[model samples]
Target: MVCLRCVMVVKEELNKLGYHYISVVLGEAEVIEDISAGQHEQLRTALLKSGLELMDDKKSILIQKIKNVIIELVHHSEDPLTVNFSEYLSQQLHYDYTYLANLFSEVQGTTIEKFLIAHKIERVKELLVYNELNLTEIAYRMHYSSVAHLSAQFKKVTGLTPSHFKQLKDKRRSMLDEM
Candidate 1:
């Protein structure tokens, strides 16, 4: 789960299965009661019907949590930290940065820093499409050190300078759903 709507869907599925949940966040949930195997299976089927899957393995669950945290910070949060991405991730996930970085790279086949840059570039595309924030402001909001840095990264990732990308307004920006 990476958005509020996803949380809503999960909550609705849990309720439909007669399960009580205290809260449903992006990647974690606190249920009121322990469910039996049959109920768990039913809930899993319902979630799958809604295009969601129940993650059961510990490593997979942790990876999902890491993804959720990054997604939330990059695309949803209003006031993100000014700190380094690794430090932010370490604090948010409550794990040593090195261990988390190694696990992320091993499981996802990409370094966490690269993953973050991809997500950040995607967010920059969205903001450019919206035309609400100027490049400098977008850079600041996205935690880039400067507009030049943001533009360089954007061009490197998308093969077009920010201004060039903005000029071709008809280009389709990728959706979070597709990411």
Candidate 2:
């Protein structure tokens, strides 16, 4: 689960199966009761029906948690981090940065940094489409060091400078849900 609606679907499915959950966060839930195999299967089926899957493997769960954390920070959170993303992720996940970086690259076929840049650029695209924030403000909100850096990255990823991209007036920004 990566969004509030996803959490709601999971919670509703658990309730439907007569299971009690203490809390449901991005990629995890705290259950208040043990569920039978049949109930577990039912819950899994219900989640699958809603386009979610039950993560049973430890590594997969950890990876999901990592992705959720990144997604939340990049696309959802408004408060900027005081530290760099790598350090923040290391502390949040309680793993060495190198280990997490290697695992992410090995499993996702791209570095975590690249994933972050892609998401950030996507967010910039959304902001540009909204036309609510100027380029400098968008760069600051997205934690870029400067507008030039943001423009360079936006151009690198999308093959168009931010100003040029914004001028098109016909470009559609892809949502995180579709990514």
Candidate 3:
């Protein structure tokens, strides 16, 4: 689950099932009651019907958590991190950055850096489409060193310059989940 609507769907399904939840954050939830095996299956089925999955595997859950953290950082957070991403993820997830990076690469078949870059680029596309901030402000918000760096990364990823992309009518940005 990467969006608020996804959280609402989960909360709705849980409420219908008569389960009380403390909170339903991006990738995980905390329920007030202990869930039985039957209840687990039922919840999984309900979430599946609404296009969500109940992840069981520890590694998969960790990967999902990583994705969710990145999504939150890029899409939700107004301020960019003061520390580097490696340190930030390590602090947030309570695991070594190397281990997380390796597991992410093994399971997702891509480096964490690539995944982050893709999401960051998507966020840039979004900012451009909004037309609220200029390129320099965008660079600062997205944590790029300079406008040239942002433009180069944007062009490399999207095959178009930022100005050109903004000018085009079809301004497409990927969903958080898709990234």
Q: Model 3 residue 72 lDDT?
A: 92
**Per-residue CA lDDT of candidate 2, range 13-129, in tens?**
888877789999999988998877887788788899999999888778878878888888878887878999889999999999999988888888999999899889988999988
Cα lDDT, model 1, residue 36: 86
lDDT of 1 by residue, 1-179 (tens): 88889999999888887888898999888899998898888888899999999988998888898898888888987784877888988889899999988998999999888988999999999999899999989998888889999999999999999999987864445443356
Per-prediction TM-score: 0.91, 0.91, 0.92
The lDDT values for all models are 0.88, 0.87, 0.93
The runs of at least 3 residues in candidate 1 whose Cα sits more than 4 Å from the true structure, single-residue gaps closed, are 170-179
Give the local distance difference test score of model 1. 0.88
Clashes of 1: 0
Give the alpha carbon lDDT tens digit for every residue of 1-179 in model 3.
99999999999999999999999999898999999999999999999999999999999999999999999998888887889999999999999999999999999999999999999999999998888999999999998989999999999999999999987734344443356
- Candidate 3 versus truth, CA RMSD in Å, comes to 5.6
Number of the top TM-score candidate: 3
Sort the candidates on TM-score, descending order. Answer: 3, 1, 2
lDDT of 2 at 69: 82
